[model samples]
Target: MPLDAKTLCLGALEAGFDTGYDIRKAFEDGPFQHFQSLSYGSIYPALNALLVEGLATCDVRNGDGRRDKKIYAITDSGRAALKAALMEPLAADQLRSDTMFAMAFVHLMTRDQVKRILDEYARANRRLGEELGRLLRDRMCEHPGHQFLLRLGEDGSEMWARCIEALRDDLVAALDDTREAPEAAPTGGAAAMTARDAPETREPGSGSRPGPDPHHPRDPR
Candidate 1:
């Protein structure tokens, strides 16, 4: 006797609420708590489908607010459906991410591959940091709500970027001293060469055969 989580979340938006945090709290310790709570996985898709159904529209503010956040709002049809959906039963939810599951096996990979992953991950984190910094500096200041959201995201990104950089630097330092080519060990033939015979030379037009070329400067007559 519960409404679908997606519909319920959209209804909340129609009731002058939007943003992921607002919807999450609306479900937290509420009637919708009986159903699975929303996450980035659920929220983004639900919002997109809502827009496709003409039930919502986003208000993207460009340039900056103080911390730049693009806000979303709901539409008229969204309100009527929200009321109707409240009476309907909630559908079951599925939580699956293959990428995350694959990452659990990262330690099983070769060291070189792991190092590459770390470097790529650090660069990606740094890019996210730069983008978030730009957003905070350009906008998000006008409203306390938006400013808080921007700061929240920025702080999280900054922390991750720093962690990634530290790990990558450590890996690079470890690799530097470990990559020298091993000196060719003295084979039995090389040992015999030093003991019994002078170093053999390849004659002109010879096909990789070792020969005694006395005419060579190193081979005395």
Candidate 2:
């Protein structure tokens, strides 16, 4: 199932996280690191909503005169909700990658730009693989499921890094071939200009623009 932010927060509490920050950290560093991501923008609001709905309780802990911290714990109702959510049929997996989308237009980019992109992508995956390796070696590999997830993340990162490196080599070879080829006459025309100026397609329900409002008057002047 596609777990909402609130359900994820509840699960974090069930997993022993006490605050919204802790919940975010759980996603960043724990077994969920590979498959899930949560930001404070979503985490704090979800925690507040959970408290309002009586699914969770918050404790105001006094700090050392700097700031107070709010710790959250799941209520019985929250536990029931979490369990029900887990038992629900899983939703289809969603894969969203802005990198992949940009790759579709790689031919429009210079070789240097393509190389830079591939370098950054490989570096990021390498860093993630290292972090997962450390976690698996240290505390996170005790549980069977945690161990499996950590290994999955570590292996996936390594595989992606290798794939990106291969892509870099292929791109470089293609660029070399393009440079060696004889130049053709420029094909500049209205059709080419229109194609270049056309806007990229946006996904459905992307909400990049507001829907029409019946109450608003259109300005004709």
Candidate 3:
């Protein structure tokens, strides 16, 4: 199931994040970060909605001496709602990658750019995999689902890094071969076809833009 901000906040409360900031951290940099994301713009509104729906409650309390803090807690109804949402059929996983998107248009980029991107992508995945592995080794997450996710993330990340490493040389070689290939002179008919396809200088025109990547994760605050 594609969970929404309200359910995400409810999950955080279930996990013991009793403050708005704490709930944000749960998705921002805490255990849920690897799989889900929510921003304040969505969080606050969802929290308010839950409150109005009698699914949550808020209490004012002392804070850092200058301002009061509002603590949030999920009601029994909220837990039931969360449980119901979780029981729904889940959508298949989606992979959205800026690096992969860039690679799709590799012919338009310089060889150096492609090399740098591949190197950085591999290093990033390796680092994330190592971090997830450490968490798994430490047994940091007690929940069976959480433990399973940590392992899944670690394995996926490591495999991606290895794949990138294995393919880098071949991709670079292909780029080199393309660059070295001679440009053949076009025949008169071929020249006319090329001219027809090309946009003329100073011509004002428009075409459809690329649609959004449906697989992308939610934007961060």
Highest-lDDT candidate:
2
TM-score of structure candidate 2: 0.73
Residues 169-194, candidate 1: write the lDDT tens digits: 44443333222211333546543333
Backbone clash pairs for candidate 3 read 1-90
Candidates 1 and 2 compared: the better one by lDDT is: 2
Best TM-score among the predictions, by candidate number? 3
Minimal lDDT window, size 10, model 2: 194-203
- As for TM-score, the candidate ahead, 2 or 3, is 3
Task: State each model's C-alpha RMSD to the native.
Answer: 19.6, 14.9, 10.5
Clashing pairs in 2: 1-90
| Candidate 2 lDDT over residue span 1-221, tens digit each | 58999999998898788988888999988667778889999999999999999999999999989689998999999999999998989788788888878877654666678888889989999999888988899774567767888888899998888777865666565554443331342436533332333234222452323344422232334
lDDT of 2: 0.76
- After superposition, candidate 2 runs with Cα above 4 Å error: 29-31, 183-221
lDDT of every model, 2 decimals: 0.55, 0.76, 0.76
Worst 10 residues of 1 by lDDT: 194-203
Q: Tell me the deviation in Å of residue 93 in model 2.
A: 2.9
